[model samples]
Target: MLGRVLGGISTSLFFATFECWMVAEHRRCGFGEELLRYMFGLMFSVQYLAAIGAGLVAQAAASVVPLTRLSASSSWHYGGYTAPFDISLACLLLAIPAIQMSWTENYGNNKAGAAGTGIAASLRAGARAMGSSWQVPILGLAVATFEGSMYCFVFNWTPALDAGGGLPPPHGLIFSSFMMACMCGSSFFGMLDSSYRPVKVLLPVILTAAAALGLTALSLARGSTSNGAVFAGFLIFEACVGAYFPCVGTVKSEVVPEEARAGVYNVYRVPLNAFVIFLLLTDISPATQFGACCCLLSVAAGAVWLLGRVEQTR
Candidate 1:
């Protein structure tokens, strides 16, 4: 429960930071075409890597410590060790505005061309660039919603599958393998993106359909005489989830303005919070109903992709 709370808080802080960073970057870049490319490659790399390190350290500490002890202390005191992880997180959150200030000083005042615009003008230009595109904002919302729903379904269903469906420990391994497949899928998609506009990419729809098929197979296997079919369906479903993930971020980046990319990316997080509340409050059968929900979400995601394309054409 504490983990969930902390995770939510952390996610919120992360998005807040991202939004601030986006606005700052826009102010700094003066609506430059390649602002996102620059920010993602340089600034975001540092921020994300720091976040990853923090997560790893936190995980390692939790693994070694007793949960009760950790919760008992006001600080992050666990077992026999006391570390400043909480303090560090707090400090990181506080540092976001400072980081923005630094970015503003560095790039916000620079003249890119003969326009000789001030930082305020640059920010306005960036805002205008973002406001020019409706596709970016809608796609951003869709990506966030899809991701939040996916996480909720996965978290709620996995344990239910283990208990209700009688899936063994090996099922966890299968899930991990599915994640690896997703990494591969993302790499494949990146390569494809080099040759095509990400919005024109059809992989999201294809993968969504595949995921739906997998879920449908699982649903059909619920009353099956053979367990093999059910297990295979689970594996297929997981793989499809993995394959579809890359498209979510790609779509966001493709549609959002260069300056507002981070802010738009952060907006994708709302679905996650909403989904958690949904899972907690709802009394649905995890395996059967949740699988149906997954299928429905996949269909909806595919429809979103199609609608985005139609909007693009018009």
Candidate 2:
């Protein structure tokens, strides 16, 4: 129970802290918004590489202390597969010094700011901020549907890969490949952003994502067991996942006020969380679930389309 609680806190912090810091730090240093897009794309690309590296490191650590049922999925190793946890602790401790050396502490809104004082007030301020701005809610809708679809993919991929009745698909290798695709995606975003605005970049990405998901869902619905085709579709969506983070981050930095950034940003997660639960909780088949995902992404694409229209009018 305690470990789960601690893990949940860790997950929340991981999602929230570094991105907030990046935005705040960027503004503090007086960097151009042009540069901000580059930084976000670069950050995600490197972050994806680091995640791959961390997986390699964890696997190496697990080898030194092998588990009873070890194959490809070394991540789930138990019975004193504790080496990764130790490494995690050491890395976290190392980050303390890294933060001290590289980061300067900054504050958000003061007591008199729009975010006000106290958690309750901050949350209320976030709600108001989200409602007040068309951009914020549209962005929130994108996060809910797009991010929710990403989570659905995560849940579905294992059963997806294993369906072909072969040597139980190399789970670890597949995960690493997915990460590499995401890395490519972030780099792709950087290149595209150099020529086009993030808003412009997002519309096609969302539409392509919807198309890819629609294909995947249609394949499953038709009972096609062609693993290669389905896997390709899955990879396409994963690539879209990579592009999504930086694009959303760049736009979010523009729309959400810094004083209420964290609060309003966290608000996006509320619908996102509910979206995931609703999708995953149903008793539907993978085809149905993925069809639902495709529908959701279509909605997100519409929202982004409207956002683009509004941006043009502005």
Candidate 3:
């Protein structure tokens, strides 16, 4: 109990410190638009690195330290063994809010003098408009659904394809390679000018096609299909899904006002968490079925694209 309490407090403090640092960074840079974008990218990269490092450390520790020894020393049962790690991860995720709060406060307080009342009023008005709009909520749900589905498919599909479809390890390697393709896609998308509207780029149609391909791959797996065909389909699907990220980021930025963007992004996380819980509760066959359901959801997301395009036209 004491260790858990201490861990939580320590994690919160670390997050608070990181947030303060991010805020200071924003202020020191004078919140220049280009600077903010680069900062966000850098922070994202750093966070990913931190996550990787933490995972490696946890894996190493698990390998060397017997669970029995740790359990005995920590007075934990098998059921409660994962709690410490969970608490640590919770602390790590809290850094996101800390950083957001810091940046928000910096903009709200420091930049107020320069923009004066008009800028503040505009921000307030945007917030109010956002609060009253169903569009933001709907867009958020679409984004969350897409994100959750992609994660579920990736996590569940690889093993299913290996076991059920008789695909070898090479297929899994192909999936990783497809992820690398996505990294390239992200870099390509990032290079495009901010003036380029992602919706106009036909991201919805591309995502819909990807979902179709994913479903096709699953169907092939179910039908005892050839490994080559299934692998090729998976690769194509993963590549397209990888390309979807930049468009999603751009859409989120365009739809949500800057002041409200963080809050809106946070709200999207709720559905993602719910989806993860749903995945956890599902059996293997059910998880595969859920992936198929996600493919259908992607078709629905394409409809969201039409709605978004209409809004853009307006």
lDDT: which candidate is best?
A: 2
- Model with the higher lDDT, candidate 2 or 3: 2
RMSD of each: 7.5, 4.0, 7.7
lDDT of 3 at 306: 65
Tens digits of per-residue lDDT, candidate 1, 1-314, equal 99779877777656544544554555555675344433433343344335445545554554465544446546644442243355466766888888777654322233354255544654455456546776654554455545555565556544544553543444324444445444444444444434454455544544554465455446554655444444555445544444444444444545555444433444445555666567656775555555545654665566567656766688
Model 3 alpha-carbon drift over 4 Å, by segment: 1-131, 164-178, 193-195, 205-209, 225-227, 279-300
lDDT of each: 0.51, 0.80, 0.53
Q: Give the range where candidate 2 is weakest over 10 consecutive residues by summed lDDT.
A: 107-116
Q: Per-prediction TM-score, please?
A: 0.56, 0.87, 0.57
Minimum summed lDDT over a 10-residue window in model 1 is located at: 105-114
Residue 101, candidate 3: how far off, in angstroms?
A: 16
Candidates ranked, most accurate by TM-score first: 2, 3, 1
lDDT of 3 by residue, 192-283 (tens): 56665665543553565456556654565476544555555555555545445545544555466544443455555567658765766766
